[model samples]
Each structure stands twice: as structure tokens, then as C-alpha cells.
Target: MVRRVGESVEARLDAERERIALWLPVALGAGIAAWFALPTRTHWIGLLLVLGAGALAGLLIGWQRRFGRAVVVGCAVMALGLLLVWGRALWVSAPVLALPVVTEFSASVESVEPLPAKDQVRLIVRPLKRPDLPPRLRITAAGEQGKGIAPGEAIGLRARLMPPPTASLPGGYDFAQRAWFDRIGAVGTVLGDIGRAPGAGDGVQTLRARLSDHIHGQIDGSAGGIAAALVAGDRGAISEADEEAMRRSGLAHLLSISGLHVTAVVTFAMLIAMSLLALSRRLALAGYVLPLAAAVAALAGGGYTLLAGAEVPTLRSFIAALLVLIAFLLGREALTLRLVAAGALIVLIWRPESLAGPSFQLSFAAITAIVALHESRAMQRFMARREEPWVFRLGRGVAGLVITGLAVEVALAPIALFHFHKAGLYGALANVVAIPLTTFVIMPAEALALLFDSVGLGAPFWWVAEQALNGLIWLAHSVAEAPGAVATLPVFPPWGFGLAIFGGIWLLLWRTRWRWAGAVPLVLGMAVLLAQPRPDVLITGDGKHIAAAQPDGSYALLRERAGDYVRDAVAEAAGIDAPLAALTDLDHVACNRDFCRWTQDGRTILAARGRDRIEGADMAAACAAADVVISERWLPRECAGRWLTIDRDTLPQTGGLALYLGERPRAVTALGAGDEHMWRRPPQVSGNDEAVPTTSLAR
Candidate 1:
């Protein structure tokens, strides 16, 4: 009997494998295309070569009926699809490709409409209108403009008008690549203006502006206005205190209408729609309840949850909602593993870049783990055969919530560390409280406030909602500040990130009794992090003072700046607060003071002319016998020593002379320099230094 049961389980696994194989091509193709389409400087020939090789490999494998032949064919198809998609994106299809090299520009908002979290202000600009340039042109303005600008008003901007860079953080994050899936390629910020903003203030934007004004007018006295903003996604009117409250409470996600908020709205709408349909029982309409509920869910949840914002998590949730709605409309099964996989595939296909984002990984990991736990036979039996009191039932619910938080925290911990460089040690506990409050209390209250507004009794409702959100904020801030709230993680190598991803997928999808197999990546990721190499040169620089520490030894600085922001950054990066003090006493100097110094065995040498600045001299002779020549000024023209400039003005085009002298003239010890020309030439000792016998400076 045990053998038979094992065989049945194996058969189910095979069936799932077969199902995944069938739909694999679409997912693979979309992913490949998106990868190739990313902004890169490589030529098309390389891509074409890859395409040909993949096609040949697929053909050969299929002809031989090799292992994983079906998978190979699917991969080949996906590669081709990606090549086509990205090729089109890089060439003719992209608007950025078609745009002229714009020089002068100006933007004026024709309208500004309020969205859930931000104001969508539309602006039109005359881009490079010179007859010598492209005459007919327009630029749309958007994003991080600081404050909301109104219609009929214009801001002057100067920029090299081109398509926005594809979203991908170089070493951090990418917003443009995600927007590519959403079909937005162009954006701009004001630089300078040729004239005033152009346009007449009128239409729907005006109405939205009026509504925003009216809401603020009504709720300005209390926290109600910001509450309305949170509900409506008009963050422009929110007070600093209210914003702080939500941020502190870890409930900031609520302020922005996201998956949690949408799920609640849809569930509530679904319940209402189902109840109304149930009341009409005798009409043979039992089958229609789900469909009606789904439609209402779409109406209430779709725009706000999905369409209202650019956040990738909302889009993922909306995709799941779509899957659920379609299933209901067809009277099929609900919320299964297959449905989750399907939703994931859809999101990956549409926004391939999102695969690397925290939202996509965290949201889906939490949901999938929760669903798996919820569907376990053990869990079902416990819930069904519970002969316990209400207290026990409540305890079980709390236990379930705790389990959910742990699952999500486990899944997201590596990613959070990888991205933020700091892991939230208490995030799980914070989430346990914050998630329930945001989902159950905050979202519903905000929605109710909207309803109250329609009934002309929103003021009281809005005030109550504000208090709830404020309480949540206070909770997050408190949690954030709790002892050991976050722990710093050593930087991990790139391969570790790949390993972590591999392990996460294994845990989530491996159809094996030995689920512990997924722990492999986790262990490897941690190992890689522990083994990372330190940088050669480290700088803790803000806009003011600059500090540098060599890998071999001590630290050096030009001077202490106005603020500690820079000094603190350096100290943190170097993992030493003690070394920064050596830099604090450095005398205050001019903005461009190119000081260079090195501290060794408690000895210090100033490379530059001490208070007396020199224009031309064999300064190298003075520091020839010293441990190191520290400079706070330019290299004397006649010094003729191997020196590397540490100063900013290294360009020859900017009226400064470029020099190169080195038998390996150590590096021209400037703050910075013009070019490699200075580093390449043999050291030439001119004037008095020519007769002085010199030794090669140690690297």
C-alpha cells in the first residue's frame, strides 16, 4: 500500500512537470526578449550569433531526442522571441530612438490630476524647435518633481532629450526597466527655461485640482485632510506628522494602495456581491454569485489596486485577482498552486525586470507560503475538527499569523539584506502586528471614509482613520528603533545572489520529500558574503570634505567639512570610528585645496608646500627621503616627480597644462588629474632637479 501511494505521488509530480513543460515557451520567450532589449552598448552582431547557435543546438537536440529536448526547444524559442522583442525595442519601435538630439527645452503643465498616492501632472514641451533641428517635437514631464505643480504653470528644464534609461539599478535598483513593461519610456525634470510654461488651465485636471482643494479646505484643521490623502492617494496634501506616523508604524504600505489594500477591497466587495446574490436564491442564480462578485471586485479593486500606481506588487496582485476572477466566471476551482504559478508566469512575462525587485519576490513568497500552509491536510483537519474553546480558536489564528510572518521573513531576508545592506532583525514581529492593522483596520477605514464622504459625513470618519494610521506609524517607528532592529550584513558576491535565487525557487517548487534541499543556496549565499574582498581605496565624501584611506594603512583628509554626514559615511564604510578623528583636525582650506597626506607609524608628511604655496620648484627633492609626500596644493611645474593628481581639474581642455613624467614618476600626487598621459611618460627632471640623482618612487 505504501509503494502504491508513492507511485501515485510520483505520477502527480510527472503530471505537474508535463503541465509546466507545455506553457514554458511563452514564459521563456518573454524573459529572453526583455533581457536582450535592456539598454546596452553592445552591437547586434553578437546577439545574432547567439541566436544562430541556440537555433542550431535546439535542432540538433530535437533530432537526437536528447535528454531535456523539449526544454531545449522551448528555451530556443524563448531566445528567438527575446531577440526579436529587444531588437525591435533597440531600433525602429522605440520613441526615444526616433527623437532628435534635443538641446533647448521648456515644459508647462496643461493639467494635473490626482492619483491614489501622487498627482499625475501632464505637461507638453516644445523640444528643440530650431529650424536646423527637428521642428515638430514634444516632451512629457513626470516624476519626483519635489512638489505638485499646477496647470497653466510651467517649469523650465534643460536636458539632452532622449528616452529614459531602462530601469535597473547599476549596483542598487532600476525603475526604468519596470516602466518599460508599463509602456513609459520618456520622462524629464526641469533644468532651465527658455520662456514661461505654455498652456491654458482647463478640463478634467481642473476638476481634480478643485476636488483636491475642496478636500484640503474641509479637513485642513484636523488630521482628516491627510487621511483623505492616504485614502485618495493624494499625498501632496498630507502633513509631515501624519507621514511620519505611518512610516514609523511599518504601515506606510497602506498609504499607497497596494496588494494588501486591494485584496481587502476585493474580498469585501466579493462578500457584498455574494450576499446580494444569495438573497435572490430561488431564481436559480447560485452560479452567478461568483461572477457578480468578480465584476464588482474588478470595478472596485482593479483601478485602485492595479492601475492606480506603478508599483510592481500591485500589478502582480491584480494579475492574481484576474486569474481568480476568470476562474470564478467559469465556475472553476479557486486559489490553487497552479493558479499561483500561472499568475507568477504572467507577471514575469509582462515585467521581466520585476523578477529582481523586492516587491515581486516578497509578495509572492509570502502568498505562496501562506497558501501552502493553509492547504496542508494537517491544517485543514485542525481547523475542521477543532473541539477547542473560542480562546483556542483565536490562539490558532494568531499562531497562523505568526507562521505566515516567519515564512515571508525567511523568504525576504536575503533579498532585503542584499538590496538594503541591512536586514530587519525584528521585521517578522513588526509585520505580525502591522500587517493585521493595515489590512483589517487601516484599509477598511480609509475605504469607509470615502463612502462617508459620498454621504456628506466624511469628516468624523476621516478623523478616525487618521488616528488609526497614525497609531500604525508610531508602531513601525518604535519597532524600527527597538534595540537591534536591523543588522548589517557583509556585502555578498554576485554569484551568491544567483545562489539565493536558485535556493528560493527550489524551496517553493521542488516536488520532493527532502524539501531541505532548498537550504543549499541560503548557506552558499551567506558563505559568499563572509568571504568578500575589501576595496583598494575608500572615500567617505559628501558635497564638502573628502577623506580617503589606502588599503595598506592609515587615513587622510583635506579638511573637516560643515556637516558630519560625509565623515559618518566614511566611518561606517571603513567599519571604524577611531580613524575618522585623525581627519577631524586637518586645517580648514579653500574649496579646491588639493591636499595629500599619509600617516604611517605615527609619522605624517605633507606632500604639498606647507602654508607657503609653490608654483615651480624641485619639490620632489624636499620629500625624496620622507616616508611619503602629502600635498594640499598643485604639483610644482618644476618638481618633475612621478605624481598622480588627486584634485578635480585633470582636464587639459580647461586651460590647465597636462604633464606626464615617470621613470614611473610615482603618481602626480594631485587631488585629481587630466589624463593617463601624465601617468605614461618617463619622468623628466627639469631645472635644478635634473642634476639631482633621483630614485623611483615606490608604488
Candidate 2:
């Protein structure tokens, strides 16, 4: 009897596999994603040639009816996909400024958006001169200098330009990589007033800016900003406090133009089209209803994507929705894994670098999990029941929301912990109220407002949207304020994230009890996270600030206010849960105006900033007493000795440093020992002296 049951299960699994051909594209996308994640740069042309030759050989073998023809063909396709991704990455690589330089030139403004700060605006400019530079440069202008700049208008200004900052540590966020993909090679601050030249903004950008301004004029405060963000993807107007609240409450996704917004807009259009078709008996009876509704939904999604600036996330979502609509038009089930796989394939082909972004990861992860759940036997059984009463349907809808919220939260938890080292502990509870309110109230109202605004009759709709937005914001704030709402997690290594992703895919893509095997890798990933080591000391990217980890799991800041951003980043990466302000305790640190000293594991460290202080007698005494000295100023002749030291010249190339203290202390920088990326400066030659050389510091 046991053998018969096992045979029955095997037969069921075989049947299930025959029904789904989606895993092919998914595997292909995985190959492409893997290619993009490599730290080492590839010789794109050479690699593609090699891969192409292998694929051709595989295809020829498969054509001859080889023993494993299907496997050979699949492998060939995946290899080709990886080559395609590599080619795309190479095509998008732009030239960045090799060194910091100040230049004055006039350029056409592509867009003007306010920064989170009070008196700063970011200008996306197209440099008229220096054609060798990247097509676009993102410049941060102080005060009201950039406030008057209009899209497409030519403006002249002098600014210091530098390559985007590298990651603070290896495997941390790489702003330079993101900037490279964005076609922004340089970033800097405006040094003087902008002078207007002869030109107008680009037509599309002008329209978007006008629409954003009109929306803001109609609504008020954070509500207007939220409305603008939903309708036009203009998040510049949103208050930082509200943004923080949404993030803390796990409702930040709602504020962005993501899959949820795209789905909502499409559903709204479909319902409207269906209702109108019902009024026309001939159309409803002619069997054109489903196709017509799908067409309308596709149009709505496309329109929304364009309105939202066709960002990567919105574009991906629209592509997925379009695939589903096409399936519906063809009289097939629309919510299949094949639809998502195809969408992912399209996104990877268009912008392979997007695979590195959080939005891409989170959105696709949620969609994949949801589709898998829909295909599960449990959900199938639940949906198979006969039509129920209104109350039962309402209860089911609420339950469905809860289940979805929980599933997405769980699916994305590992990624969140790996990247940000924080999880919204109360995200499920918060979403129970937040998702419904945003989906049914806020988003719909904003859509209506946008529709009305285009026709100059949007006042009432904007007011309604504003009211709903207020409630949503309040809910986010309240939830964020709850006790233990946020959970700080230990840092998870890249391999841990890899294992978790693999386990999730294995469990979701397969049918049958064998899928339970995925639990092994999932548990192993959790173990890796728990076992990861924390850095004992961290230095800022600018080398102006440093922090030491205390025995009690707190950080001692070397400077009070200079490296606030780095302080927070290091604290999060080190799994320090205390508030930033409370991390530095004077009881454990000794400091004077010029220098601060801290000890960890019996090793003394000294940090100094000002030039005058570095030349003072106090600095000499501190350097003599400490085992490691980090000075913002150039290293003086007197301080050369066995004690390790980092000074101005080496800091720029290193970016940031992480120290591990033991019997033999060691150091690692943001640029790894062997990293050879474009943004990294060339290695510096060191002279033989008592001053510890860069290469010797890590030894």
C-alpha cells in the first residue's frame, strides 16, 4: 500500500510538471541576474564570443537528437541569456570624471526636483561642453539658486564635480554602480548663482513638471506631495518625516509607483469597462466583453506608466499586467507563472542592471509568491466553493488581504534584513489597515483627481484624495509609533541571501511534497545570518569620522556631528540597535577638542581632524599612546612608527575602512583588496618609513 501511494504521488508530480513551462524563462532570468551580481568586471566582447560558441555547439548537439537534447537546449538558452545581460551592462557603462575638478559651463536642465533638505534642489543637466562626459549630470544646488530653474531651460553655473561615492564598505550599497546605470557619471554642488541661457525644457519633462505643480497647488501639505507622487512620481515634495513614518510602518511601498498601484489602476479600468459593456447588451452578448475589458485595462496601465515617468518598477509591472491581459484575450488562465516569467525576462533584457535594485527584488518576489500561492491546492480548494452570501464574501476578502500581507512580508524579510538590516515587526498588522485604505481609498481617489485635473474639474476629487491621504499618513505614523514595531536584525552575508532566494524559488516553483526539501536551505540561511561576524571598528567614507564597537554592543563615535550618515550606516551594519544619539557614551571615551581616544580588545585608537591640532603637542602624545592613528590631515613626519595610520592621501582611494582587532589587528576598505572597478582610484605607492603602509595595515 505504501509503494502504491508513493507511485500515485510521483504520477501527480509528473502531471503537474507538464502543465507549467514557466520555469524555463525563470531559470534564464536567474542566469542573467547572476551575471549582473558579479563583483569582477568582465570583458564583454570576449565573454559573449565564448558563450556564443558554446551555445551554438549545444544547439547542434541537440539538433542531432542527443541523449539529453532538452537539457542541452535549455542550458544553451540560459548561457545566451547571460551573454545578453553582459552585453547590456557593457553598453550602458558611461565615463565618469577620473578626479575631482571644478568647471563652469552652461547646460540644458532636464529636470528640477527639490531635495529632502530645506533649501536644496537637484538639477539633472545635459552638459553642452565636455561631450566626453556622461550625457546627464546630477547637480545639487544650494538655497534658491536652483528653485527658478525650469525644465529644458539653458543655465550656466560653476560646480565641483566628482564621481559618485563608492560603497562605505565592501558589499554595502554602491552608489557609483547605480549612478553608472542611471547615466549620471558625476555629482556635485553648485558653487555660484545660475545664469539663464537661451532654451526651453524638454517637452515631456515640462509637461510632467507642470502637472506636478498643478497637483501641488490643488492639494496642501504632505497630502499634496503624496498625491503628486502617486500621479506624477514627483516624490520631491513629500516631507521627510512622513517618508520615514511610512518606511517604519512598512507602508512605503504604497507611496511608490509599484506593482500594487499598476494593478489597482488596471482593475479600476477593467471594472469601468465591464460596467459600460453591461449597459450595451449587444456587446456583452457577442462574447467581446472580456477582450474589450482587457484592452481597456492595458490602455490604463500603459497610460499610468507613462504618467509615472516609466520608471523601472512601473515598467516591469505594466509589462506583467500586459502579459496577463493578453492571456485573458486568448481565452487562457491569466494568473500563471509563465506571465510573470515573461515579464521578468523583458525587464532583464531592457535593463539588466535593475536586478541590483531593491524595488525590482521586492516587487518580483511578492508577485512570484502571490502567483505561487494562487496555484497551491489550498487556495484552489478555497476558491472552488460555491458562491457565498455578501457577509461571507466580505470576510473572505479581508482574510485574503491578511494572507497576502503575511506572505509578502515573509517573502521579502530575508532581502530586507540583508540590505537594510531592519524588519518591520508589525508590518502584517499595519498592512491589514494600510493596504485596504491605500488601495480602495487613496489610490482610486488620486486616479480620479488626475483624470479630473486634465479636464480642469479636479477640485472636489483632489479634496477627497487629500482627506484619504491624511488618514493613510496618520495610520502609518500611529503604527510606526507602536512598541517594538521595528526589529533590528544582524547582518546577513551575500551567501545567506543567495540561499534564501534559492530556497524560496525551489518551494514555490515545484508541486508535490518534495518541495518541502527547500526548508533545508531556508533554515541554513537563517543560521548564516546568526553566525555572521561584526566589525570592531568603522571609518567614514571621507575618513573624517570613526567609530569603535564597545564590548556591550554599542558604538563610540569619534566625532559628534560630522559623519552622521556614516555613523548610522555602520551602526546598522554592525547590528547595533541603540539610537544613534545614545550610541556614544562619554563614560567609555576620553576626548579633547582636537582628538578622541577609544579602546577595544586592549588596543588603543586615536582620531583627529583639524590641521592645527594634528601639529600640536597633544596630538603627538595621543599618537604615541595609541596603537592606531587616523588623522584627517596629512601624516606628519614625527608620527611615523609601528602604529598604523591613515591620512588624507590614502583616504580618497580607500573610501572607508573596517578594522578587526585581535592579537594581530587587520583592516579592510570599501574597495576590496582586489576590486578593480572604474570608480576606484589607482593604488598609491608608499615610501619605506615607520608610518605603516596601506598594504601592511591589513597584515
Candidate 3:
């Protein structure tokens, strides 16, 4: 009996050994993602320990190869992944201004995009002489000041430049980190920008801008906007209302140029090229027909990538499409997990920071799930069954679409809740109608429009594309208007998301019955979603705006009609569904011209506007009555005792603050909770004389 048990264990271990190579890249990717998700940036000492330990273990395993070779290899690969991500982080961690600076400067516009607002444009600029600064800056211009500015046109302007804003709350979206990877050092508004400078040069951005302009000119209104979005990836032309409707209906992905669009364009190009070649007997009989078709498809995908601005998502899709095309040319199955792994590995090697983004996570998750479903035994058996009647085939197609939509939605639900705190409940129903229209009619027409526009014959194709888009838009609006179409949830904690991702990868990658173990972490992640805590008090990054949680589970703004963005962030963090416009009911708030006061947990909190109003008797009274005093200006020394005081000096380092009121109240700040990395400015060491009396509750 003991010998039989030993034989069974050894057999299971050998079977697992055969699958280790397939799991290596996924494990490596998880390691890289884990590194980026750290609360504080890793130092060289920790990295050295990881690498050295992994190497030592690998060497020992090689010496005793009968037992743990797979484990050793996984450790080595994970360590290597961590090393690569750390190296990428260091490479991209260039510094921006620590404080906001108002300066006059000249830069060449690399690209110009219209904002959602009327008469506003955002210019991506390259600095001419400032090597110390970031490679690019995003500048906002109003009125006609930047109307006709094309890419590669030098413009001189006065602007107030600052580092991209940090996360509004701890573990919230880190715009600063994103800007760092994007090579944008600063973001500013152009005060006055009509002057043309001397130096400018043409680039890919120039070509894309020209193409976008031509597309916009050829089409008009919402139809034109959708056409431009499809052809040039200029989504800014679409109205916010339309965008919102699409999001609510779960059709927003159609607006972005991604895997589906790239696949459609490449497939259409290959089909068209093959058809034309087949028409000519000489070309059809040629030995290189397959290679020629592959090349055409590759070129088509590459051209579309260039038109779409080659952003991270587009680049990833292009790489994946190219890999699939290569596999097809090599007479191998195209949509295998190996191909996806190769594509993912290549993208991570090129830009490890992308692993931290929602687009990268959600896109890859959906793709992996769909591909896994296709390769499942049940799906394969269903596909291999005897031919069915026409009606049965049609029903099967509908069922396939619904299944694909469900798989993708289920795979991406955790990611959506983590990033955006919402999910579209009617996405599958909307996609049932929307995907066919987009894949068959809209995308094909847009491809034809692109081809025709090069020869100044695009009007008819644009019209056809517009008609398809009109149907899609109507469907989106109708679906979004339905009750319970969108479901909002609270943001999941980082660890919960991490666990969910691991479980998802386990389920998708494993090929054995043991894969069901993934359900454990998946369930735990769902529990975490229900267990997440809400903040009692929230403050804006600028320290000028504040919101406090009320007894009824809604947030009340200290000042009305100000800091809508901050209010929204706070509300989302707290899982509150209150509208920004409806947060003006100040019945619970006591306010005068200079100060406003609110109470929570039997503690009075004071928000003062000016230093003059916080002096002498009023100051003493505020300190005596309030548990926390927040002010825009510096406060006096006598007002610091049992209570906490936050003012201008402390606010700069904090960014934003969240206070938890209990028996022993605590607080956390955005900066205090964030990773101390090279991209961020270190917190200042205040002198004793200037130090404020406040306790940091950052964990």
C-alpha cells in the first residue's frame, strides 16, 4: 500500500513537471505586477536578496534535480520578472517640478487633441532646450489660441506647470505614476498661445494629425466623430453624453482601437488581397500566395496601429496580431495560449509599467478567458458535433456570442470594480446586437473609408459607416436607458484584486481537474469587496475642499459649487451614489463667510478660509471646540494641544487626507500612504518650530 501511494505521488509530480514551462510566463507576469503594486518602492538591497536567493535555490535544485526543478525554475523566472520591472521603474522615474511653476517657454507641438469642452484643445508638446525637464508636456489651450496649431509647429506660451496630480486617496488612481511612464513631466494650461516660434519638424504625429483633420472634414456631427474615432482613434470628437451612454451599455470598447478592431482590419485586408489574387490565375497559382497574404495583413495592421497613435493598448494588440499572423504563416494554430503568452511577454519587456494599467489588465484578462473557453473540452466537443440545420446554426451563433460576452464580462468584473467602481449589467445583451454591427458593417465601412480617403473618394464609404454607427448609437442609448443597466460597487482593495487576478490566471492556465481550486481565492476576493471600509472624512488634494460622511451614508460638502472632481472621488471611495450637483444641501453644515463647521462622531471639525479669521478669541474658541481644524493659511502656535491642526504647510506634503473617527480617531494622507519612489518628491522634514501637531495614521 505504501509503495502504491509513493508511485501515485511521483506520477502526479511528473505530470505537473510537464506543464511548468507553460505556467512560467504567467507566474513571471504576476511577479512583475506584484512589484508595481508595492506600497513603497523596492530598494536595491531587497532586489539583491530576491535575485540572490532565487539563484542560490536554482543552483541547489540543479545539484539535486530529482525533486524540485520546476519549483526552482519558477523561482528564477519570478525573480527575473521582478528585476525587469524594477529596472523599468528606474528607467522611467525622471523627476518633474516639485511645486507648481509659472513660466514662459517655447515647445514644438507633437500632437493636438480637442477637449470635450467647446473651443478647447490639448497640445502634446516637446520642450526645445530643457533637457532637465520631462520629454513631453500636456498643455490646455482655450478659444482660438491653439485652434490651427498642427503637430510639429513650434508655439511659445506662458503657462502654470505642475507635476501631474497624485491619487486623490490612498490606493486610488495614480495619475502621477501614469504620467511618469508616459514621459509627461508636467501638465499646464496655456495662458496665451498665439506666437509661432522658428524651430519645428515633421513626424508620425504630424501625419496622424493631418489624417485626423481630413477625416473630420469629410464627415460631420456625431457620425463624423465616430468615423474619426474608428479611423484615427480620435475619441475626443465624441460627446460626453454619447460616451457615457456607450459605457453604460457596455459598448465603450468599440470606440477604442484594440484587439477586435485590429483583428477585423487585418482579416478584411487578407481576405480582400486573397480574393483579388485569386481573380488572377497567375497570382493564385504562385507558391508565395500564403506569405503574400500574411504580409498584406501585417502591413494593414501596422498602418492602422500608426493611425491609432500607437498607444499601449494599440501597441499590445498590434504585437498580438503580428504573432497570430506569424503563427498562421508557419502553419500553426493561431489563437493558442502560447501565442498570447509570447505577445504578453513581449509587451511587458518593452513597457513593464503597462502591467499596472486597467487597459492592459482588462484586455489581457478578457482575451485569455475567451481563448481558454474556445480551447475547453466542452466547447471543442460542441464544435466537433455533426452538422446542424440552418436555424440550429443561427441559434448556435447567438449562443456563442452570449457565451463569449459572459466570459469576458466575468473575467473583467474584478478589474472594473477595482478601477472604476462600476459594471454594466446589460453588456452581454447590448453586445449581442452591437458586436455584429461593429464587426460586419461599421469596421468594414471605416476600412473602406480610410482606403478611399487616400484617393479623395471617401464620402460614400463614410456615409455607409455613419449609418452603421447610427444604429450602434441608438442601441447603446436604448440599452443604457433601461432600469438596472449599470451596477455600481465600492472599490476593492489592492490585495483583493491581486488575489482575484491570481485565481483567474490559475483557472485559465491550468489544464487539470485541480484548476477548480481557483474558486477559493475568487470567493475570498468577493468577500473582500463586501468587507472594504469607508472613510469618515475626505479632503481634496489642494486642501481647499472637504467632505464628511453623514449619518445617512452620504457625503456633505463643506462648500457648495466647488471641487466637484474631489467630491466625486470622495463619494466613489465611500461607495456613495450621490450626484455631484445634488450635494449642495448644507442643512447639517454650519457656515459663515470665513469658516464652516461640521460634526461627526461627536467631534466638531472646523474649516477656515483665512488666517485673519483664525486669530485671538475666535482661534481659541475653534481650538477648544473642534477636534480637528483645517485651514488654507498658516495657523497660530497656541492652537495646538489635544486636537489636530492641518494648514498650508502640512497640506502640500499630504495631497489629500482621510480621517477615521472612532474611540481613538486616526487619519491617512495620500502622500504618506503612497510608495516612496523616484518619480515622487520626498516629504519635507519640517523644523520643530514649523511642525504641525498631527498624527499620521498611514499603514
Expressed as tens digits, the lDDT of each residue in 516-599 for candidate 1 is: 676887678766755643222232211123444544434444554425544434443333324453453545322224334544
- Per-residue accuracy of model 3 over 1-699 as CA lDDT, tens digit each: 955864564565566564545676776776687676554654444754776686677576463542346556666777777778878767766556556776665677887887533567898888655544466888888857777677877667777787788887655688888887776778888775456643432223466667766767766666667777777788867776788789878888888889988988899989888877677777777756677888998998999899889888898999999999999988899998888888888888788778888888888988899999999988877666567898888888788889889989889878877887777888987899988898898877877888887898877988888888888889989988898877666544678887887888878877777778898998788778768666777777677777777777777666666655676577666666565433235676777667777777877888875435546555776666788888767777766425678887788788677877878887777775455665675222111222222111100
Global lDDT of model 3: 0.74
**How do the candidates rank by lDDT, highest first?**
3, 2, 1
TM-score of candidate 1 to 2 decimals: 0.68
Candidate 2 residue spans exceeding 4 A from truth? 1-16, 41-74, 115-119, 131-134, 198-205, 383-392, 452-457, 581-585, 613-625, 636-644, 649-653, 662-668, 677-699
Give me the displacement of residue 7 in model 2, in angstroms: 15
lDDT of 2 by residue, 1-699 (tens): 955874565465456664346556655666666565544555434544565676676565445433224445555666766777667656766667666777666678887786533558898898764454456789999857776577767777778887677777544687887886676778888886777653433223456677787877888778788888887788877787898788878888887898888988899999999989878889988988878888899998999899888889989989988887888778789888778888887887788767778888888888889888878888777756568898998888778777877888889888777777777767877888877787898877777877787788877877788888898889889988898887666445577888888888778877767778888998888778767667787777777667777676766666567554676687676766575443245676776666667777888877774546445443566577788888777877666424578888778767677777878777767665544443443221111123322221111
**Candidate number with greatest lDDT:** 3
**lDDT scores in order:** 0.50, 0.73, 0.74
Highest TM-score scorer = 3
Candidate 2 positional error at 637, Å: 7.1
- Candidate 3 at residue 64, lDDT? 51
Clashing pairs in 2: 151-201, 152-200, 152-201, 641-690
